[model samples]
Target: MRQMRMSHDEPLLAIDGLKTHFFTREGTVRAVDGVSLTVPRGKTVCVVGESGCGKSVTARSVLGLVDEPGRIIDGRIAWQPGAGEPVDLTTLDPKGERMRRIRGGEISMVFQEPMASLSPMYTIGDQLIETIRLHLPLGKEEARDRAVEQLRRVGIPRPEERLDAYSFQLSGGMCQRVMIAIALAADPALLIADEPTTALDVTTQARIIDLLRDLQAETGMSVLFITHDLGVVAEIADEVVVMYLGTVVERGGVDEIFHDPKHPYTNALLGSIPRMGAGAGRRLATIRGNVPHPSDRPAGCPFHPRCDAAIGGVCDVSDPPHIVFGEARSVRCVLHDDGAAVGGDFRVDGERA
Candidate 1:
């Protein structure tokens, strides 16, 4: 594997003002709007949000995988390859050689649906070996050996025997493991796991999370994990980013997010999680409404309508100011504006007051 020359202070990936939109007959859908975050070297950053909050789209945007009608209209994705100066991924042609090489070779992704991602037409071995050869200069036999090693590394049983098995032949958890094996075949510096454990059973999900953590420790790869499960975030996230309606609502350390959430949306989400040892008849808490459709987004603060602490005239009329507490901690909310609630001067530019 290649050594990363990046220093401890520099982040492995930095995204700034990313805006991905889909132009359709009905209207333009802003899937990811002005989203900014960073993934530190060899650490897990979990992007947590409800469905339709653009978590998957944001992950896809990083890999240049957004499909037709959907285009990355604005942004800068600075990728530090640990050698030369950082490369701006947003400028590369999606289908060009450099982007293609970087997509699976440098930054691999384990897609949401393992079965849908793996092809039933080919044996798992064929898929894995193909991926290995695409990025690594290895003979067919060597690639096959590497594929088996990857499967074994991911905890698949009877690695050699399973290599010839088709995606439909394996269980959901097993297929997910295979997808992970393919993703890791080239030893990518960064792994984008888009809800990889969502379709698995509780036990399987835990195992997958453990496997990823262990692999990260072994390979020193950064993980950008996208999920709605705060439980999973608590398990693996070094930093947590909360998204709402295509924009980041809050971001901070995992402990800070869970213990001292600032944004009303973040507080509501934490409240909605089922707690243990509650009274027998106690009802679970829930957020009031569904995420608004992108095309029908509300005016001003996107979350104002659902936020309980919203300043009616202010939040509904103007965009919430971005308030920064310190490096790596920020919230976008009118309540946090200076003298309003938290007593911090809010900046429209997301700078510290």
Candidate 2:
């Protein structure tokens, strides 16, 4: 394993202009286009968007997990390991030994479906011990002990006996917990949780979120959480990245994104969330249309077809420029562009002028 020193000043992971595409027989599918974001040390950055918005693809891209037919066409994924120089993950071979070590040892991922992610043939302990042994230099018995300790840490009751059980024998919640334990067994520097809570019930989801937060507090690992649920973002996210049709539409601090969304897509998403006192029988606000098909993406701004605030002439004819607000906030929308010909005044502070 490679040794990496820690630095608090720089971001743990930085992805810039990442584009992952699939060269299918019919047409090219651009899954992640010009997507950029950073995962600051020990912070949770949640990537939010509707289904098929490339949230999962972007996460997979970070770990060099984009499968065959789908390869990164352009862009750079710079991973900074604090002490040494920054490594551009985009240039590394996906199946190479260096990338393989970084994928699970330095950066681990908790996938969406626990049951599907874990093998039904192997006992829970077998998988967990394998992961631990692969990353750490330990004897068989030692690895097993570490596996049991991890299960206990993840709040699994009777962890020793539970380890002997297969994934199919455990409840959904238990399977998810086991998956989490396995992901953390190697003590990765960054945890890419790809909608880990999406498959659980409301109560189970809450517990899982709480567990992640607690584990982060204990381990100080940065997390890249991918999900479509705004409520989940509100609970755990320090920062938020809103993606639309494979590109980032808006990104900023969680409080800013929720309270003062700059992009129409972001506003529409916020409005769609169920509220405490929204009144009975009231229709929840919904975005006009589904995400555009990857191969059939629109000419200009991808969100224009569904955006209520889209300027017909400009948004349809040309792509929106990325507008910057302070240091940590940005939006790609004609409505926020200063040069765009629109009726309402646009301010750099993300407000009406």
Candidate 3:
């Protein structure tokens, strides 16, 4: 067998052509169709898209959390654990022992709804201790102490007291903090946070983002953050992947995606971000049309229907290739096709192309 070498350039997680589909009674719902991205070690990679764009499904698929009727049908999820071999996560059984060890031990996730994630029956301390003990070879007392420390690490006030409290006792922000604490209890190398700030207030959201950053800095762990909010992406992301429908439309560094978005969908998303000093009466830019249903997804370029830069008989007729722009940026659009104009800024007024 060939040995897997861990180089500095190797990504902590590399997903390629991932197709997570749900076989419903009506038809197959291609929730995450051929989505690919990478989370480098010690860096934050944010996947941004509107609702129903398969952002959550992609995150769930990463941890083998996709429920029944849905399964990862294709591609490989290469997960590099330290200097050891890179394991293919997609090939593992969802409920099998190896995956169990990998899920919470190698990679942990903080979900969107903290209240729902935490059990109402169990006290926070019990839950945290259980998770810690499950992943680590710690006795009950040691796990309990570690749980308290993890709570403190996440900035939960009076960590020892809060540990014994139920999930209902904590506010929304505090509940989220506890979720992060649980995720960190194992000291996983990769942390997958799925909209951890969606329901939080602005200040609380900022705090949560900062907390994650601090934790990453302390642990040197990579993060795969899934959110629709570009503001949060801008605040924390080192790399950004823009998903539309079920595929990655564009992906680049944070500044590249924000300043020079090539895909129409990406450009529209960047324009939609609210500015601080906008005119009082100006309306925020909005992307027109809704995300197409999985069953009713359009042929060829999935985004061509609403894309202003879409060329007639071209974009709707054939799928565009992944246009590579140097090493850090890649876009999926017809405007960047061979012999097509691939320079300058992308305007949404139907005039750029």
Q: What is each predicted model's overall lDDT from 0 to 1? A: 0.91, 0.90, 0.89
lDDT value for model 1: 0.91
Q: Distance (Å) between predicted and true CA of 191, model 2?
A: 0.2
Error of 2 at 5 (Å): 15
Each candidate: how many clashes?
0, 0, 0
- Which residue runs does candidate 1 get wrong by more than 4 Å? 1-8, 339-353
What value does the lDDT take at residue 126 in candidate 2?
94
Predictions: Cα RMSD each? 4.6, 2.9, 2.2
lDDT per residue for candidate 2 within 1-353, as digits (tens), equals 22334355778998889999999999999999899999999999999999999999999998889998999989888788666667888888899998988888999999999999999999999999999988899999999999999999999999999989999999999999998999999899999999998888999999999999999999999999999999999999999999998999999999999888998888888888888898999998788879989999998899888876667788898989999997889999888666788878754332455
Deviation of model 3 at 111, angstroms: 0.5
Residue ranges of candidate 3 with Cα displaced over 4 Å:
1-8, 340-350
lDDT of 3 at 282: 95
Reference-based TM-score of each model: 0.94, 0.95, 0.95
Clashes of 2: 0
Candidate 1 displacement at residue 155 in angstroms: 0.7
Candidate 3: minimum summed lDDT over ten consecutive residues — where? Answer: 340-349
